[model samples]
Target: MIDVKQPPYSAVGDGVTDDTQAIQNAINAAQAGEVIMLSSGKYLCGPLVGRSDRPLLLTGTVGAQIIAKPNTRTLLTIRCSASNVFQLEFVGAALTSVQPFLASSCIRVNDGLSGVVIQECKVSQFSGAAIIANASISLRVMNCDMSTGQLCVQAARARNIVLERNTFHDLGQSGFALHGDGIIIRDNVCYRAGPVGGFGAVQAGSKNILITGNHSTDGGGGFELQNENALSATEPSGSSCVVAGNSFTRTFAAGIDLFRSGVVLTGNVFNDCNFAAGLPTAFTVQPGIVPDLAGPGSGYQAGDILTLGGGVFTRPARFVLNAPSPNGGLCDPARPATNGNTYVIDMGDYSVFPTNPANVTGGHGTGGKVIYTNANIKARGSGYKSGDVLRGSTGTSRFPVLVRVNIIDANGAVLEAEILFGGYYTGTLPTEMAFAAYDTVSSGSGFTLLPCFGNRYAMQYSKPSMASGGSILGIGNRNVIVSGNSIVNHSPSHDCGILFVNFLNAPVSRWAITGNVFGTFSKGAIKRYNFGTLSYDTAWGAG
Candidate 1:
């Protein structure tokens, strides 16, 4: 271990003298894996850089602090891999009024560094993020106390990052803003953080992420999933993630604002959350699909084949089948149909048609052939207006579906759908679909909306008396299991214990909401709009 106070490169830790060059010299001279120790006094320093080849350990005794001088952007920048910074206090100039350096950070890890650990440190009084990292891998930060910063930690394009057992308070923005994949945030506590924009204490967008055992009190919210980097299309943002075993209390916004896909939430608690009177909901789920407002256009007829287009990300083509016709011999004698019958057979509850016409045969009968001739609107896409024209694919196509919009709703949603041409489609539906004058591309990238497919177990919500929102609110989510939850002591003016709203009229299928207990809700235990294909059982009231 090399001590900074005793040597030819002596660092004067007197709280007033400039120790920038002395500290830099000690760090430069340290060999690989050697410990550079600092005693208990304050060391005034400007910007310092860690050696790339050394990977040295920087440690400090109790009450040891490195104070940033005026006009310093970053106190220390680490470019080395596998470096360790432990038990130090990073004080910035924002604590004082005169000559305060507002835009400063305590530490910054350069891009592509890996296996860096920062533990048991105190960081405070900076306008920018206390710790900033980009494009790093395997970074771990634990047992730290951070306060009085715009943000505690901000990371982007990083992977396999773990932040655990940290305490954050009095921040202007979120405690953590993380992006990329394989992130684990656990056992962190936040109080009075995320006040500026009402972002969650832990706001992240990543794939394969796990956020658990955290606590947030009197803050903006508990957790949110939103992409911080919009330009990176290849990165996974909020897909295949899990949020479980967290606590959120007395928050201004929802306890959890979930906007991504393929997420599982369970074993969490929201107590008195959404207490701010104007906020609508405690736990909110918003969909990412945008639909066109104008009605399906006028020029398309019943049998036309239309191609789908203009989504944020590319998806597999889907179509809805209608107006079935019977051909050949009768397949089922119980359900008799003539050869010219055009009425659609009741094909159970399935809405989407198979891609191949051969799969459309023998639903109610064995030998009778059923052909679906009419193509209809399965989903009305967004960003369309009245008078916009929709056309099918070109080139080797025989007849293309043609349509022009004529009517729209107050919010520009399509209300009337008319087909202008009855075109013939064979084999399978074409994969190309486009619109003229109504195509709007997605504004941001790294967002793809998939169905929610997971199990929720034993969550608790209690005492949101200041707002008129549901304890749990979901919009446009599917394939979820909500079981063994308890919602108690809600305000009488609130809507319901749980509420779901589906504006797009998409199929809300495969949802199992069961074994939930509710108490003293004004509306009921649960309420929904445009709900589709659900199993609701084993639910009761406590009082």
Candidate 2:
């Protein structure tokens, strides 16, 4: 059975809530399943020593912060044989401890153990790692933030561990790392780590692992998977690993570095890679997300529609559809129903013909607004030009629409004006908000550019539908599609337009890049390469 109770000793500071006695009481009295809750306040105690054989927990008042003095060998040592939990905050002693001897770490999970969980705590500013799970223990650390320490979390020869929803920022070395099995890391945010000493975001060697939904920014390119220092026994180890839906932006090394076998890489975006530009393919691997493009009444049709998650799309034209039957072994059966293909061409622009949905509500539609007309005086301009400003019915004036220019004269003279939509004044020939810059003008057709070796353009908009600072969708285990997002106005120091990399050689196959804007990129946009099985749909600017 599980035990839950409070600590015995309770001591408060004079005019200061002294929690030293309270902590000792809790630790001494805690039974196998009891919890020792620390009151909210500063506990000016010396090093907290854990009682052997007593499964204990040192927690704090929800809002209460705790700090211990320095010179203590270990802060809240764990010698329990059974499963134990240490939640809240526990720090080393300071102030009263000799100078140059402040404190080492906030906590330590010591000696052979199993089923240990350390969660929801803020541990940092220590000389060593925030928490060190010494050799031979299985641990689960979830929803915690570790920063400013030599190392955030380190486990030597651990197993069955999971680290999820945690944040590691501004550290000297790796974020969270372990040597174990059944490890899964998801939805965590790591930034500005490594480059101080020799550090990577995550470095681990585990079997049957799943690392998904995480974002690593700046510093190192992202993750590294290595064989543990211990010699192998040839025991069918470190196989079946899946890494997906993670974003690595402005990284120095490759987005993900793999050193072993049987891993899969899909739907992970890498933007503005520094140390390792594009993907570096190595080892036995597979690319999980690839597009199956069969055309014109063939591949994916109306009935083939799937649910679409939100994200940025660089190319906006090439849509993926299914072809006629006999299509058995072509597509991966594990493809999720939520995948959709993206293309360039402003297919939603009304100037071409019938109006598409302007603002779709409910029933899963593009939740963004599209505004373009024949003229501003009549409604809105259907055309575009450089420097065109848009004046809405409401008193707000918008851009790229208001800066329209009429025919370029022989002498390079450009005529500028505020135009209306639909109808024009007599002999005035009112221009639309949209206008293609190059000389080629084709009526009834949206702007199309002949393929040029290297071309560049600029656009401005409010914001993208995806979250400002997070990954939108994850691609895992082969066969996927990323489509339809109008990305714009990206700030510097930001990486990615649409990223593709495979850690397990699950080389992304048959990918279709469509319908997304790449606005103001200091680095070149749409970076793609491979790390695993050499197969995938490789198309850039697919309009």
In order, the Cα lDDT scores of the candidates are 0.54, 0.42
Which segments of candidate 1 are over 4 A away from where they belong? Answer: 95-102, 197-205, 227-239, 278-467, 471-475, 485-493, 497-511, 516-519, 525-543
RMSD of each: 21.7, 24.1
Q: What lDDT does candidate 1 reach at residue 172?
A: 47
Runs in model 2 lying further than 4 Å from the true structure: 1-8, 13-22, 81-87, 91-103, 196-205, 228-238, 275-543
> Largest TM-score belongs to which candidate?
1
TM-score, per-candidate, Cα-based: 0.58, 0.48
Per-residue lDDT for 443-503 in model 2, tens only?
2113211110100000010011111111211222223334443333334633344444432
Question: Could you tell me the lDDT of residue 515 within candidate 2?
Answer: 45
What's the residue-level lDDT of 36 in candidate 1? 92
